[model samples]
Target: MSVDVITFGLNHTSAPLAVREQVSLAGELMKPALTALRSAFGGAVREAAILSTCNRTEIYCAAEPSAARELPAWLADFQRVEADALQPHLYRHSQDEAVRHAFRVASGLDSMVLGEPQILGQMKDAVRTAEDAGALGTLLHQLFQRTFAVAKEVRSTTAIGEQSVSMAAAAVKLAQRVFGDLRQVKVLFIGAGEMIDLCATHFAAQHPARMTVANRTIARAEGLAGKISAGTMRLAELPEHLAEYDVVVSCTASALPILGLGMVERATRQRRRKPIVMVDLAVPRDIEAEVARLDDVYLYCVDDLGRLIQTATDARKAAVVQAEAIIETRVQHFMHWLGTRRVVPVIRDLHEAAGAMRAAELERARRALARGDDPEAVLEQLAHGLTQKYLHGPLAALNQSEGEHRDQLLTWLPKLYPLRER
Candidate 1:
């Protein structure tokens, strides 16, 4: 079976967070999801990688072509969404199209914010998770390694990432709208991952009155806090410290909501109804949606940030055209490599078969010479034996063929077995 290199998924462009969260796989759950996908599909799917990020959840697979067709149904079943409902939001690509998609994604062309660099790290994380899950194979491994290379090349060659508006920047922009001056507000980052780190950096630059990092792992929180000279606390201490900060940004891989309606309600009451700007960057959401209804709690999910970043769409379109041209050229180059790979087995078989035929004929010629036959005559016999054996099948086919088939074979034979005129 021929394996297709493919990617299919929904992203910020296709579906809202309400739908995206249902399909998003937490890091811990990825291995199990990969295992289940392999088990369900069997050998049709040889190698698989799942990339679940805040903006997208894409599956990259090196699998039989049939698996590509069937994957959507499998995803729908796994996500417990209607197949029809998911189909419209999902995009599928095969072969070079898949390679192009992977490259563009890593290079940030497909990002909600054009040329944002975070998706590359997220893709790397997903690749690592797939490796740990034992879902990575030579095809996917090579594809991703090249993907990173392409992303690096594009970043260096073009101004793709320059002056790009990042999700972190958008988060900061939203916070500024709520709080007139970020310098007077205290900011809390409720996760130690890349997104939280980024948000911390943006807010830290604004020189907030106080900055705190709260994480399930206090060590990680402290590590991030130390980088920005911010205070750190364990996630368990959030309830007590929640009211102290006016701006809250939380993005974690947690499967459940970290900040519930009640928690925020209590925190708001403690602050005497002072406005609290909350940005929930997690797919499953770190802040509860119900908290958005509360008067003092201004809750913003991933979708909210996505909207803020959309303003760059017009400016990015020009770069996108250039990026697409680069991607198209690279796709063709990769496909040519794939094509060369396909005929490798045929080339190997031809070499082995011809070597065996040569060896057998040479052995026969040596025996004849030992039996006192003339060397020149024996060499002639050897040449005849090799030539006859090589041409036997085609000669017989041509002779047996009739009408148009015979004429076609006659036309092809001389070209296939060209003779040097004496």
Candidate 2:
């Protein structure tokens, strides 16, 4: 069966944070999700890759058409979210649209913060995870490779990322809005990952009263802390000292939410209603959704930060136009590749049939030669046999068809045949 390129899911544009979070999967959950896609549809699905970030949860697949239709439902089931609830926010694309979407996404054209480079890195991680899960096949593998190429082209050729406000920078910007001066407020960053490092760098520049780095790995946290002249603590100790900091930024790879409603609630009670600004940049989310409702807490998720970063996007709008044009051309090229792939089976079948005719004719010629027939006559018979067999199918179709069917055959037959003077 010829596989179709298909992608379906919700992004920040189509769904709210509540909807996106319900569908987000990462780390240990990814392998099982990829496995679920294959098992849920049996052999109908050939290859699959899931890209679940804070702003979007998209599943890309090389699948049979019918199997592609089942993806949204399969996704909702795996995430334990209702299919109906998910379907309204979900958008499915196949063939050219799938290629276009992948290109647009990797190039950061479709991101919540357009042209932000973080998505490219996230895409790389998703690809690696899919490969590890044995879910990547020829179609998806090529799609991603081209997607990366297109992204690099966009970044190098256009100024899409120029003057962009990064998520880390947006976090600081939001925090500064709430707390007038970072110099007076204490900042605590959770996780020692790149995001945490970026956030620490941005916040450290403002020179907070005290900075703290907490990670599951104390050594990693210490390394980050020592550079910023900040203190280091175990991630376990965050809950105890949570209320002490005025600004809390958390981005961790923990499967489950590290900071829950109850934990933040207690922290808020300790602060006596002093507002706490928290940025949760993790995909599955380092902070709980319910915690956002707390009166004294300012909770900003990735999408929320994305919205804040939009003010500066005006400068990069020109680059977006340039990037989109590049993407359109690439999408057409990719679709052409897919179009050729559809004829591959037919081409193979023709080759096989032709080979069979050659073998049969050559064998007959060998027998005739053994019977003392002339070499030139045997060669002539062999040539006639091969020619007749090759023309039989097309000749039969052309003669049997009527009106438009015959006309269609007349138009296509020459293209199918090697009829040109060679």
Candidate 3:
């Protein structure tokens, strides 16, 4: 049975925030997800890796083609979502298409914000997680290594990442649009994760009138706060303190909304219709969707920020063409490697059969030598036996074949043996 490379999942483009959040896996859930996927396929999924981020959730696997079709339903079952509902948002890629998708994703060509570099690190982390779960086999290992190489080549050789604009920068741009001058607004950041750290840095550079970091872990909040010379607060204090800030940015791994409609409503009441900018970069979302409906709240989710950052410069447009060409060339290279692997089992069987034949002939020769037969005659017989045995298969095929097959065999035999020239 030949194994195939397959990629299946949904991203910001294919699925909305609501659909994506339902299936998104946190960093700690990767191992368990992979193990479950492997078990669900009854070992047919020979190798697997799951890459989940705020913007997308993807599963890459090496499996037989027969088992590939069932993957979409399996994902729905595992994520406890209705298969019918999830199917529309899902995509499946196999063989060369799978290799191309992996390359494009790592190169950031497939990102919500094109040419963003963060997805490469996220992909590396996913590979590491798969390795830790013992789900990474030779095929996937080779794929990711080539994926990283392609990403590096694209970034270095092209201007793909040049004039880079990230989600963090987008958040700052949104806030500035709302408040006119960031220095006049009080900014509050929720969660101390990478996204929040980035938002803090960008907003800090703007010199907000006051900045604060609130996290479930006070120590983490304080650590991030100290770097930006901001104050720290416990996440629990948000209810009481929410109205004090003109700008609020949040990104966390929490499975539930930290700021619900009721909470935001109360905050709005306290502010007396004063405008507030809210950026929620979380997958499950730190703020509830209903908060967007509030009159005084300017709400932006990951998708909204995605829209804000897509104003690409002319250089970036040209860079995209260059990056895509690089990715296409690398994808072909990877597919060629996959194609060559199909002959591996046949080569292995040939070597094993030859070894057995050689051993049998050697044993017969040893017995003759023990019986004191002529050494030169034994050596000649052994050489003739090996040569004849090696030629038997092709010779028999050539004799049995009628036309085209025989012609192919005749053409290939000389290539198999350049000694025919002598």
Candidate 4:
């Protein structure tokens, strides 16, 4: 089978938030999803990893050709959606295409914000998770190692990361507009996922009066809170503590809103008309839209941050051009490597055939020697037999060819079988 180290998935470019969220895999579910993917495809899938971020959900696998063909069906089954429904949003890449996609992704070329640096770290985390799940293999390991190298080269050689506005930084900017100075504000974060963690980091750096994390699981909340030396609270406690914080930022995968209009109204009353800034970075939204109507509460959604970040597009365009050039050069280099891999089987076959011919000739010489033939004659015959056998096919083909074909073979033969004259 012509197995390919391949990748398939949907990203922000291909799918809407509604569809992306439906198929998104939680970090905790990654291991089970990988195991299920392997089981569904059997031996065709040798190794597999799933990277599910808010912006993308990709499956990377070392699988046979048949398995690559069958991956869409497996994804449909895993997500419990119709194959046709998922197929429209999906993109597939094999061998070099796969390698190029991975490199671009790690280098941030494929990000929603082109040339963002966060993706490289996210990709590293994906690799670590894959290794922990025993999903990494020779093919993926080599691919990732090279991927990281390419990312590093792209960053160092190009201005890709210059003038970049991170989501965390955007959050801070949005909060600043509402609350004036974050230093005097208490910021509360809902959920301890990567987004919340990042938001916490940026806001904490502003030296907010206090930072608090509220998670469905208090342990997770405490874990993230401890990292930033922030306070922790249970999700249930958010209703009570809502009024205490001046700024509230939330990003969670909860199917429903965690913060409602009533809670915010209550919090606003408790704060006695003081302005409360809120940013809901989640798709479904952790804070309700109705809360935005409150007089003293200023609420911003993901789209708002997206709009704010868009202002930097013109400023960063020149850097993006430089980054794309770097990515293109790396892509060409990777494609050359992939092309070399394709001829490996032919090279192996040639080596095996030559070895067999040598063995056959050595046996013949041994038999002749045992029969008491002259040692010099036996050795001469062995060398002649081996040379003739090796050259027979090519010689016969070259002799029979005519016109341009003959000329082409004649030119190629000299290079293939060079002779040194004494």
Candidate 5:
């Protein structure tokens, strides 16, 4: 069976944050989702991986071509959303399109913030998790290896990353816009993940009066605290200290919103309606949508930041054309590799049959020598026997065919045995 490379689901370009977040999978949630993906359509799905980030929730798989329609429906069912509701936002690709999508995404050309390097690392993590779940098979493995290689090539050769407007930097910019300077406003960073860490670095550069790290894990929070010279607090301590921070930037893997409308409403009341700059950088969002209605809150999500990063868009757009050309070339190469992979089984069978013929011929030659037959004669017979065995199938086919079929065989026979033509 030839397994195809297929990619399905929605990205920021296709879906809104609300829909994207509902379909997103992370950490422990990935295992069961992968299992469900592989089990879909009665095992047409051979291997699968899901990439669920703030901007996209995509499924990459090695499966039968028939699984394409099933994949999106399966995703809707898995995410507990209506299939019709999600269908319009979904996009599916296979063969060259799928390879091109993977390459463009890994190279960051497909990202909302064009050429953002964080996506490559996120893709690598998705592949790793797929491997851990035993959902990565030969096709997906090769696809991702080539994907990463193409990403490296594009990044190294193009100026795609130059003058980049990162989400972290965007968060700082949003905060500065809200409060003329970041020097006096106490900043509280939620979660100790890469996004939070990056945001922390950008915020710390502004030399805030005070900064605090809030994380589910105290040790992780402390680690970030030590690096930034900030105080640390447990995530459970957020409600008490929420009123203290003038600016909040959160990026956590929590499936549900951490700060609800009521909680933030209370915090704002406590703060005497003092405006708080809040950047929710998580996919599922650490902050609730309703909280944005609060008078004292200036809320920004990942998508909002994507809109604010237009400064580098022109430079990145120029680089994108060049990077896309590179990706197109690599995508063709990968598809060629996939085409060759489809014939791997036939190639393996041919090799095994040829090996068996050689072994049988060798056994006969040895037996003739033991029976006092001439060694030279045995060697000649061995060569003839092996040649006959190798030619038997093709010769039989050619002999039974006529006209076009025979002509076609005659045309290919020489190519198969170019030594004979010589």
Candidate 6:
């Protein structure tokens, strides 16, 4: 069977954060994860790219159809999660569905926060990583190039992203509800990644009393802090300073929780029952779930933020309709292009066969002329030879085939050799 385009994985809609984090492949682990994906299928998966972000973990592959069935198990094994547990949350899209999924994702139609722009950059980073790992091939490269084009077209032509209620905005909104006045609150961002940066920008606009960024690397933390004109601190300093902030926003690539119940308990004790609004944006969760139970702490996770932005504006709803229509048309065009690829090998073989026939006929004509045969006769014979050779296969098929097969060939013959007006 021919290779197929396959996309299989889970996203925010299909799975909760717990399952998503289990299967998530961080940036540094992408190449190794891709290698394991290919190896798992014993070469059935030819070309693959793994896109692992906080909201989703998708594996886009050029693979035999049979391989797609095993992908869930491969993911379960790779992540060391039980197949039975992971299988329920997984979704598989093949051929056109797969292409459409990629386009919708890049276009932000499928994000937690509708029309948010960060996913596009994250997708581009995933593609770059795949390319660097040598996992990308012509089919995926073409798909992504078109995906980017379609995303740009949708964003430019439609108001899908207009008046967007981004996750960052949602986080800020939640903080305002909890603390009532952001101007009086001190905010601390717990990561230097894109999500954290976005959250920092949103919170800064409120002109909070103070802002600070903390990361594993002080340099990265300092970089973001400088942009927002906030203070910087190392990850190690978080425990000592956690009590100082009235609101905490965290998103990081950490596989485990950074802030545990014990740490939050200590912070709360120091704050003397002063309410602190905490937003944990990471997949594995930067703040421990148990921390939510604290009396002095109001905790929120990504899912909580997602709920706030679920309802779209009327204008955005209209834009979504337009965007989907555009995407559907583009999907059909891509599928048509993919269909043409199925005949590529056949076309090449036809060219090779025709070349062989021409070479054989020319050589025969040359030998005939060398042996003193009439040049005009040799030329006629060569032309006749070429025509007969070209017609041989079709003629044989027509003579041997019966009923529907013969009828199909007859219909194709006219298309293959259309009559020219003379």
Measured by lDDT, the strongest candidate is 3
lDDT of each: 0.88, 0.89, 0.92, 0.83, 0.90, 0.91
Q: How accurate is candidate 3 locally (lDDT)?
A: 0.92
Q: Root-mean-square deviation of each candidate, in angstroms?
A: 2.7, 2.3, 2.0, 3.9, 3.0, 2.2
After superposition, which runs of candidate 1 have C-alpha atoms over 4 Å from their true positions? 77-85, 132-134, 313-316, 363-377, 396-415, 419-422
Candidate 6 least-lDDT 10 residues: 413-422
Please give the range of 10 consecutive residues that has the lowest summed lDDT in model 2: 306-315
lDDT tens digits by residue: candidate 3, 1-422: 77999999999989999999999988878898999999988768999999999988999999999889999889898889999999999999999899999999999999988899999999999999999999999999999999999999999999989878899999999998878888889999999988899889999999999999999999999999999999999989999999999999999999899999998999999999999999999998889998989998999999998987878899989999998898888888888888888888899998999999999889888988999999999998889889899889888888899788888888888888665465
For residues 50-70, could you state the per-residue lDDT of candidate 1 as single tens digits?
999888999999889888899
How many clashes (backbone atoms < 3 Å, residues ≥3 apart in a chain or on different chains) does model 6 have? 0
Output candidate 5 Cα RMSD. 3.0
Which ranges in model 3 have alpha carbons more than 4 Å from their true place? 418-422
* Clashes (N, CA, C under 3 Å) per candidate: 0, 0, 0, 0, 0, 0
Q: List candidate 5 stretches off by more than 4 Å.
A: 41-43, 311-314, 355-392, 399-407, 417-422
Clash pairs of candidate 3? none
TM-score on alpha carbons, each prediction: 0.90, 0.93, 0.94, 0.82, 0.88, 0.94
| Clash tally for model 2 | 0
Q: Candidate 2, clashing residue pairs?
A: none
Tens digit of per-residue lDDT, candidate 4, span 1-422: 65587999998778776677668786677888887887887788888877777678898888998788888888888878788988899999987788778988998878776677777887888888889988888778877888899899878877777777778888899888877777889989998988888888888889988988988898999999998989888888887788999888899988678999998899999999999889887765678888889998889876567557654465466766776677677778776775687689899999999999989999999999999999999999998998899889998998899999999997788788875744
